[model samples]
Target: MNIPEYLTSGILESYVLGAVSDEERREVECLSSIYPEIRQELDRLSAALEDYALSYSALPPIGLKEQIMAKLDFGTEAPPVETETPVVALPADSGPTYKITWIAAASLGLLVLIFSFFLLSQLRQAQRISATLRDSNETLQTEIQRQRDIRQRSEDLLAMLRQPEVRIIRLKGNDKAPTGEMMVYWHPHSRQVMVEIMNMPPLPANQQYQLWSLVNGQPVDAGVFDVTDAPQKMGRVIAQADAFAVTIEKRGGSPAPTLSSLVMMTPVTS
Candidate 1:
């Protein structure tokens, strides 16, 4: 409504007497904020009521002011100091700008450091595990290589033994070596008979044991051999006959075995 119409509605009289309803108070407060004239009128109305009230109380008994002041002071020598200072305490976990930012940054940094330490520790542990696994793999590879070598040797021996024409000969201890024993294998097709000597100590570096194949009544040099065959494969080949022998011959072997070194001999089966 227009200002004149609002004034004519008798609402200004109610406002002047503090009788404004709650709804009317809100409307008047909004209008007063928007309109300078309305605000001025409200201010003037408040002054008028104040002045009217003062005029109405003018006949009050004198000495009322003195009575009010005397009761408050009790006639003390020093006036009391104002003990009530208004303190605006901020809420917890919230406050000034510098403090809030500092707290937030410090909290984030601590969390990052903790996580980084944890990640580093895990990485170190994983490296240790990888090293252990590498060592284990190397060990397994070494064992596999050794097994392969042994299996190959065994397979070679088995293939040789399967030949039907392979000869087997036994050599008894010689007269000087009463209890010494030996054997010979003569595979005619392969022409590779082996000699096995028992308790024949390791040969000197430049010396070796010799084998002899007796043909007719004469001793013929079969070949020289070493420790690899001394225990399981031994002996000689006789083109014409039936006997084999072993002796501590020289390194290159003797066309004829030294009689004193004669260690063992065997006769072939017909």
Candidate 2:
């Protein structure tokens, strides 16, 4: 297993923050048990988060206990009973009972208040961790999709090259770009055309490379394309071409080839 890659994947952080799904949580537990490095990192992240939460904790104001107790309305003592006989005096210890009860009530309220503060701090920390995990997941997904696209393009090019009916045409450089080179894959029966860029100079803004197919000495538009490493499908060749050419044109291309901007061309071989 690639231990370093796994460590930097952000899963460990999510697990430590209690934000992972059940399956992921189990995976982390299983890995941590087997790998000491994972276990150590997990411990470190957990301790760091705890310390962060504590750093933001706010202490209650002084005399808060006394203030809460003062606001509590302990019910008034009962009035002395009206009796025909002599009334007995109450015990001294019994006089302190109400005071003890009020003190207990105040302590319980203070405990609840402190617990609420701790819970709020924990919730905020979880939110920040969740945002970080979300961004990491998005970036990972984009990279994965990009790799898939490149693989698919390569497979397609290989399949096209293997077709018996497909003809390979190499267009070499002209005076405008002596080092420019590109390839065209043309299927006569299907009239499909694909271009692969080998080497070309960068174009200015609002300009693109346009392919032209010469049929009976007349220029026919094959399509506009950008210079890229991957083979790109272009407009179909409607008829058999005597030659293939490339020229610089406006971004969307023009109806007719720009003769002065012609950069590459090659005659078709039987």
Candidate 3:
């Protein structure tokens, strides 16, 4: 149990104000008896509230007794009217008791009002905590799902690479980019193609890298890709190609390749 957290949780204030449910009341009582610090704090709060109530005690108005007596008929001969109910007379010494009862009732009412405000504050705090926890749980779930997808993609890529029919092509830098390099995986039977960036220079925001398959001296648009370390799947190579090349293009690939922007190229081998 985190003692400091429990101490600041507002349960003690609720317990002292007599606003806690029976189960919570019992928990407070049990914990207070077991912990000296809790007991001391509970006693201090009780004393403080008692002092506060006494400070706000209502006092009787001045000359109240005299005013009441002045309004009564003290003359010996007084007319009496017949009534269905009999009038009950109070004992002469009931003044002090009545005064004490009235003060006690007023103090109880003030305590009740204070307790209501404290409980409301506690409820608002609890609602905020609940909302924060709900958001955190949703974020955690999204991250977990993202990781699962990444793992599944990695496993699939490994399986594809192990196939006997797949061919590996290493494209080296051309005159346009002396240090750029890339790898291409091609499955002739399935016509599937995947590209991996080994090394590449960064491009401008408005430009991306495009893959081209040269067939009968004509460049075919394979796909466009971003510069990332992960292996990316591209358009299938339906016909056998003589070579593969990469070029810088607009955000999306164009119908024809820009020969001047060629960065890497590799000729196919039998």
Candidate 4:
């Protein structure tokens, strides 16, 4: 059940004040044994009531005390004495009783103070836990959104590859690297281009693979790319090209292709 809501519904206060029905009283008793928060609240409420009662404690009136003493003197079962008897009663000292009463009151006040401090500490600890849970929940939501975005991108790429009109160009290895092979998916209708690295030798840290579009018998820089199993988008195909080629270049690529570094090229068809 919603324990916090139940506790804040003011039913516990009625239960503490002894105003609840028998059923409710039993329910509270049963839950107190099962839930620590409920039990702690019950204790705090009871302690508060006891402290209130002690705060207003008062002695009996003087007239009421006299009547009580007179009744006690006459109601005794001792028989009346015929001879005169001397009444030698010494006055009683109530110093110890008064001191003990104050001591008990002081101890009760101390206990109430300690209970208040404990309740405050628990409240602070609960707030800290709530804040931590809130932060963790936010982080989890962000990660979930990120994964969903990645999944959508993968689906889009797969859809592009399934298009029958998309041109699949197989670029073969050249003298620079005999075993290098790569595939380029050029979707002219959608103006999208992607590259799949099948087998390409790894390059040094300061070098990377770059793609070039052979347009009008001239090499136009498509973009610099990396060799990964997953398909990587090389931006849109802006120029009409007869064939595509791959070359190793400086890390950030160059304005024009480096012919000596050409590692692969699309087959020349006549």
User: On a 0 to 100 scale, what is the lDDT of residue 215 in model 1?
Assistant: 77
TM-score of each: 0.40, 0.53, 0.53, 0.46
Which 10 successive residues of model 3 have the least lDDT summed?
Answer: 89-98
Which wins on TM-score, candidate 3 or candidate 4? 3
Scored by CA lDDT, what does every candidate get?
0.66, 0.79, 0.79, 0.75
Q: Can you tell me which runs of candidate 3 are displaced by over 4 Å?
A: 1-124, 173-179, 200-207
Each model's total of backbone clashes: 6, 0, 0, 0
Model 3 C-alpha lDDT versus the unseen true structure: 0.79
Q: How far is candidate 4 from the true structure (C-alpha RMSD, Å)?
A: 12.6
Steric clash pairs (candidate 2): none
**If ranked by TM-score, best first, what sequence of candidates would result?**
3, 2, 4, 1
Worst 10 residues of 4 by lDDT: 90-99
Residue-by-residue lDDT tens digits, candidate 4, 113-177: 55554565567668768988999999999989877765765677798889877778899898789
Candidate 2, position 121, lDDT: 52
- The parts of candidate 4 lying over 4 Å away from their true place are 1-85, 169-183, 195-235, 242-270
